[model samples]
Target: MIVIVDYGAGNLTSVQRAVSYLGYESLITNEPEKIVNAERIIFPGVGAAGSAMEEMKARGIDDALEKAFKSGIPMLGICVGCQIIMDGSEENDAVCLGLIKGTARAFPSGMKEENGILLKVPHMGWNGLNVVQPHPLFNGVGKEDEFYFVHSYFPEPLDRNNVFGVTEYGVEFVSAVGLKNLFATQFHLEKSGKPGLLILKNFCIWEP
Candidate 1:
């Protein structure tokens, strides 16, 4: 069975429902033992970085996540779930799992705004994605397809090779990533409808 890490974050029911739409068996759990035994893991989150990390750490979800990732289980992190994989996030001033060598920082202010004002904070809604490289997680998705995004910060990988896909706001940011067996995306596939289900299904069938 697939496991959705539940440390009190993200749209758990929507994610579970999306998994069901793909005809997969999944359970949302925070227990370490249950996570360890799961065939695949989905880490989803919708909230601020510091509080989310605190919640995970308070419940020992951080340690459990570390173990699950090291075990090489197929894991997918969405939004805040994706941010925690990096070394740190500027918004929180707190450290993260450091699974990947990168940092997530706030959106840059639009140049046209003389006061260095942001184009928009919490960049919500749909945007197109460009497949920077082939990734198992995006098996059935496409470059022309638009995915739902509702995030204020985006990851900037030090090593360009780590970025699997790119998306633009007022600036370009890494939208998809692959670090070894771990995969993550800034988009909400659960809310993407049919295309989203295809991505989830691909992740389930992907051997890695």
Candidate 2:
């Protein structure tokens, strides 16, 4: 069973629905034992980074997640959920889980103006991803494959090789990251249509 963490995240239902569509059983819950004991964990979130971290901490989920992740379970994070897997975020002054050594910060303000693309904040739309590592998370997809996105900020890891896939806005940046058992994406595979499902399906079927 795949456990989708629910701490008042807006996109939880859509994610759960998509998972069900793929024929896998899933649960959306904040219960620590259920999450820690699941076959896999999907950390999906939306909204302010600091507030989300506070919610995780308040529920003692922060500790539960750390325990679960360290136990070698397959784990994936989406959007701000991805950010938390890293060190922390420049957004909302939040101290993240730091499982992946990096920081999530805002896109450069002037890049769009200088690059000739009238970019929008929050980058809410379908975007193309460039595969850097041929992994199961991006199984059945290619560098040209596009996925759904809904965030303005992106992850900037100190080690660039940790990036498994990338997406472009005014400039290209890491779209998804894979390091050991921890997989994360700045784009929402749950909302990316067919290509997205392929990715999630791969995750669902991945072995621990």
Candidate 3:
């Protein structure tokens, strides 16, 4: 069964619904045993990185997640979940899970696009990805398809090899990362449309 980590920081219900919509058995729980034993793990998150890290640590969810991933279970992290998987985040001076060697940084204020038009923070709405590498998660998904995003911070992997996709707002940023058994996206696949659903479906069947 798939386990969705319920660390009090995620959009767990929507993730669960998305997995269910794809005909997969998923459970949303904060229990360590369930997470450690899950066939796959969905680590979905939103909200501030500092607060989310606090909750994960207080409830031992951090240890649970690390254990699960180390066991070779395929895992996916979304949004804030993706951020926390990095080494640190600029949000609230938060130290993240450090599962990936990277930092999450906020989009600078007073930003402008190539045309000098002001770019918005939060980086919401749909944006297309420039797929940089091949991975099982991108199976049957188009590189040009737009995915929904709702965040101000984006991950910057210390090792560029970890970056799988890039997207641009005021500037280009890492949109996706993959390493070993872990895969993560800054976008919200649950909120995205068909192309997004294809990602979820791919995850449900992904072996790596």
Worst 10 residues of 2 by lDDT: 109-118
Runs with alpha carbons beyond 4 Å of true place in candidate 3? none
Instruction: Give a tens-digit lDDT track for model 1, residues 108-206.
Output: 765234466656678888888898888877877866788899998877777888899888877788888778778888888898776677778888897
Give lDDT: candidate 1, residue 52. 80
Name model 1 segments beyond 4 Å from true: 111-118
What does the lDDT read for residue 138 in candidate 3?
Answer: 92
TM-score of each: 0.93, 0.95, 0.97
Order the numbered candidates by TM-score, best leading. 3, 2, 1
What lDDT score is found at residue 167 in candidate 2? 76
Error of 2 at 84 (Å): 1.0
Best by TM-score: 3
Hey, what RMSD does candidate 1 come out at? 2.4
Q: List candidate 2 segments past 4 Å from native.
A: 113-117
- Candidate 3 per-residue lDDT over residues 69-101, each given as its tens digit: 788999999999889999899999998888999
